[model samples]
Target: MTNHSHPSTTTTHSFKDLISMRQAVQSLFLAISLFMGIMFYLFVAQLESGAMPTLERPPGVEAFLPISALISLKYFLFTGVFNTVHPSALVIFLIVCTTALVVRKGFCSWVCPIGLMSDGLAKIHSWLFKRPVHLPTWVDLPLRAIKYTIAGFFVWSVFFKMPLAAVEQFIQSPYNTFADIKMLDFFTNISTTSLCVISVLIILSIIVKNFWCRYLCPYGALLGVISFFSLGKIKRDKNNCIKCGKCETMCPGRISIMENETINSLECSACLRCVDVCPAPNAIGFSLVSGKVPMDQRKIALVIIAAFLTGITTAKATGHWQNGTRIQAYQEHVLQDRMSSQPPMKIPANTDPEKMKRMIERMRQKKN
Candidate 1:
């Protein structure tokens, strides 16, 4: 038997350093998201205050409108036209899905703000429990299916149940166009029920590592399903058979790395925790193909970043990154009482005067 005790000389950085690098990447994305949120709040506040927004609305804020994006996606597929109502929402959605196909749901691990929160809660869990809490396989297996079921329901509703015309109508609806603002209100003006639900989730996260990601996040479920076809995967070496179980212990996905030569599990986020914990040389690593040498963690990180940046750059160049919704429309929507039974028609601010006049007339007719 080959002695796999010697650490592979593939990368000079230690496992701890690799983990630090990942955390740093996660922090950078989280900071960007926070900045976007602040900018959006200022933009909305200006609108509500009846002042011209000094700061332009950050199109990146539309990333929160995933349901709108899904509707836009279906409409696009059916009509061969991209919806400008929230183009960035669809653009961000596509970027996320593309990353999953290329990097195995790395978005959940490296980019999502929610993932960062979950990681922080997991640390609290570790401090509280000392040893990691492991749910029994019987219970765990069924719970893991919940996210998939949720994802499936959305996909089916949008793709199978709704007709093409309905999809287009939904994409063009006032609700879809203003979903980002609604999402912001959801957090800024959270109700008691929402607060209680969030509190419970936070508590559960402290007790169970990645409770939301493992069982509830429909977005993660969609990505996980797409990641089944990811080019890269965690591969284990059986020949260098020193299975000390460190890899399994460290895996957030709770996957048994030693049991399989190739990890094709949907739950595997390709977070590299298993690779970081493996002590034996060439015993476990991420590979683009079966039986190939594993790529360095630094290289994998670069690839993931490059993929996202490239997608964003392409979207920007193609004029699909920003919605055409004008500042005026947002201002009107903000100032008006949206809770009224008859909300005003949401026309994009950039529409021609004649078109706007006709649309307003049609809305008036419908109301009367």
Candidate 2:
């Protein structure tokens, strides 16, 4: 590979500017998520108190229900119909998956609230340690596989083990209908076991950069697997590289970008830290195609935003964004004092079996 010896040139903007832009994007999504959480809590509180909810339920909160979304996705594929219980869950899921296919786990870096929290913890890790700790390959490799194994188990259970009828049945079950409320309670009324697990993960993250994201988030593993087929990637110009190793040092995923002309590693989160830190001009950047011109951080930000907005907008226009489940369903489910236990895999109380049957028949007719 050819090498350059010239001094690093100044670009239009500094790496800090790029990082600030990413932070801005992350902050926006985190704010939205928090707002949704607050709104949903109020809505549920009203329902539990035997009062009509004045605050409309925020459908965006459904984004947290990834397992329900996966099952909904399979149900849609098998029956050619969207599950109305948590339609936005599947929509957000698709949007995230699309980002992975186009931008290589950009959702993890740009959109996820957990990612924002992880980034914050990573900064703390940097402050605590003079040099970041990296586990040995033997330990790291197995730890990384933990996420894939978790993802695999879910995919296998939902897509392989569950038959089409069972998928439909589960979608209509009380568990799926009230999953969002259960998720809220999981945090609001945090259990001892859950608290311990979260505390341990937080402590580990403070010591190791991106500890949970890199080794535990099955959702991230799913995105990483899909990103292998993404058209966009971080490309390294071997000719202009100075072999300074700054890129690898700054990589959150611990990917060795200096060793590869193109970073095809599943761990690459498209965070652009490497690109921002590169001293050599045009040495490393995000590119749509291999050996092509690199895209600016601003443009990548716009693309991620646009992809999300486009997917949500399309789903809304097609009447697939908001769920069909009535607010009364939530109120009734909550008022029955049923929030304390896991919902049974049966038709929810206060739901009309005839109405559900008609709805399923309508879906089949539409398919035919």
Candidate 3:
């Protein structure tokens, strides 16, 4: 089954080095996420102050608006129109899904913020416990189904249930246009319930490797399903196999690497850690199913990263990278959502008239 005919020996990276490359890629994306968050926050803050924003809104912030993207995707399919409400959201969603079709769940391992966090927590689990924890099979099977269940609901609701009219209305709604702001608000002003749930998830992830990615993330579930048709997978060679269980243990997906000739599990992210830990030079490696040419470890990150770069470049060139929503509209929506319900502060009669006038003027300026 191993089609990796005489894999190249010149590559200097071991499994450890491969892991380092993965971390570097993860860090790069994480930094991009943070920068976008900060810039987006600043832009929103200016809008809230009823002032024109000094910074241009980072369209990448729309990446957090996945539901909006799903609606836009549907709307586009029926009407042949790419709505300007949140163009980058759809662009980002398309890029991510395309990567799944091309590289399995590599996005989860190399680029997901959650994946980066989980890796850190997994190390903590290692330090805190002497033995690796494994969930009982009977209990584990149902637990892992939760993500697919959640993903299925969204897929059915958007694709099968929502009509084109409703999809278009949603795309044009204030909720969709301002969703990126709301997403920021979800973090900046999180509800008690959301905080509690997040904390619980973190604690659980410490106890269980990748609790969210493995069993709770609808996004990951969607990617995993699409990845079934992915071009690249970890194909194993039976003849070159050493029976050592290192690959299985190193796998973040917790796949039984030795049992199968190819790592075809939805859980496999094609992180290539399995290739790194294999002690034998040609014992095992990632081989594309279409042909015998094995994918080099160094090129895996390049492939995924290049896919993103190419997609984003193309989107920008095609005028779909940014939304056409006006800044004035964002300002109007922000006040309508955030401040219209707020009552004016009652001025005490004891206060001076000039001070009262100043306060009232400030409020008027903010409302404007």
Candidate 4:
């Protein structure tokens, strides 16, 4: 990431760096996101076709519905009921927030699909320019506030403005219940305005290092604030004594690593690229409080994945992972919007014969 060019020795990566391992983890999660998108599309297709979905809806798709997650989070706090309408949304939100507390926005570098895309855009930025185009402190500092302002607006509106009753009502509202399908439709049937906006963001990301994450993402802004209290951080060993500017030039956060023993900037995503590029051994690492125990990209990736798996597994065990929206409700909502002619609601495929018989008879009785 350092823009300064030097005649350098080829660096051989050791287990201590493990940058590839971190990427593999990102790719794994990214692939999982794609799979969930496909499954959810098929599940919705079955519903619209008036057939039973042999494949269950992937609740992991709820990860994209963060506002619903925020509302559900407040509802759970107020009522102590983990509402079923968008249960997985709340579960995913809590899991991600927990990672910021433990590892300082590792979720951005290690898990989020956007983060992976951001990294690619950064490389493109490097290729397009001879040296990194950095904004001056006077301008950069003010721009950073934009995301915080955006995140603050949401926090204030949802957490402070909405009352307990309003929170409960939103969770049960038809909009919240059917949000996942609406999300699918948004992408599958994208409008011109949305497409143009997305293209602009991608282009900006390519021009500037992680433009969305650095200056515009509300989630990244919130995580950055939480990262101030993170348990692990980049710790530098000054006594090891190579004051090379490589680490600073390589830093995506644009932080000055040599000035301090610990890197406390909210912009640090725990990507560990600094550690990977450093020539001096034992000079810097992601270490815990005493600045002795090292956490490589591999170890942190495991911790991030473990945190997600544990949270999701516990949610499933408690019967709060899958949503409770009835299949009939989904049929009615999807077809109402998508189809012109109504088809007879059919028994879901691959169900017990007796159950299908009763459901068909029940539909017949309702029609008559």
Best by TM-score: 3
Which candidate number maximizes lDDT?
Answer: 2
Alpha-carbon runs more than 4 Å astray in model 4: 1-17, 339-368
- The residue-by-residue lDDT of candidate 1 on 1-368, one tens digit each, is 12232223245677789778888888988898999999999888888777788988899898888888898888888788887899888888998898787678888988888998999999999889978887898998899899999999999999999998788778767788788888999999899999999999999999999999999999999999999998778777788649899888888988877898778988888778777767666677776654343566666678778876887888899988888888877876775645463666686778899987898799879845
Q: Which digits, one per residue and each the tens of the lDDT, describe model 2 over residues 199-304?
A: 9999999988899999999999999999999978877777888999998898889898888877899998888888878888867777775534346667778888
lDDT of candidate 2 at residue 236, scale 0 to 100:
72
Clashing pairs in 3: 15-276
- Pick by lDDT: 1 or 4, better one: 4
Order by lDDT, highest first: 2, 3, 4, 1
Per-candidate RMSD, Å: 7.4, 8.7, 3.4, 8.1
Task: Identify the runs in model 1 with alpha carbons over 4 angstroms from their true place.
Answer: 1-9, 291-293, 338-368
Alpha-carbon local distance difference test for all models: 0.82, 0.85, 0.84, 0.84
Model 1 steric clash total: 0
TM-score on alpha carbons, each prediction: 0.88, 0.88, 0.91, 0.87
Per-residue alpha-carbon lDDT of candidate 3 for residues 1-368, written as tens digits (9 for 90 to 100): 43344242235677678778889999999999999999999999999887889999999988888888888888888888989889999999999999888778889999989899999999999998888787898988899999999999988999999988888888888878788988998999999999999999999999988988988999999999999998787766778777888888888888988898766798988788777777766766665655365676567788889988998899899999889999889988887877664887687879999988898899889856
* Candidate 4 lDDT over residue span 155-183, tens digit each: 89999999988888888888889999889
- Which residue runs does candidate 2 get wrong by more than 4 Å? 1-10, 338-368
Query: Per-residue error at 316 for model 2, in Å?
Result: 1.4
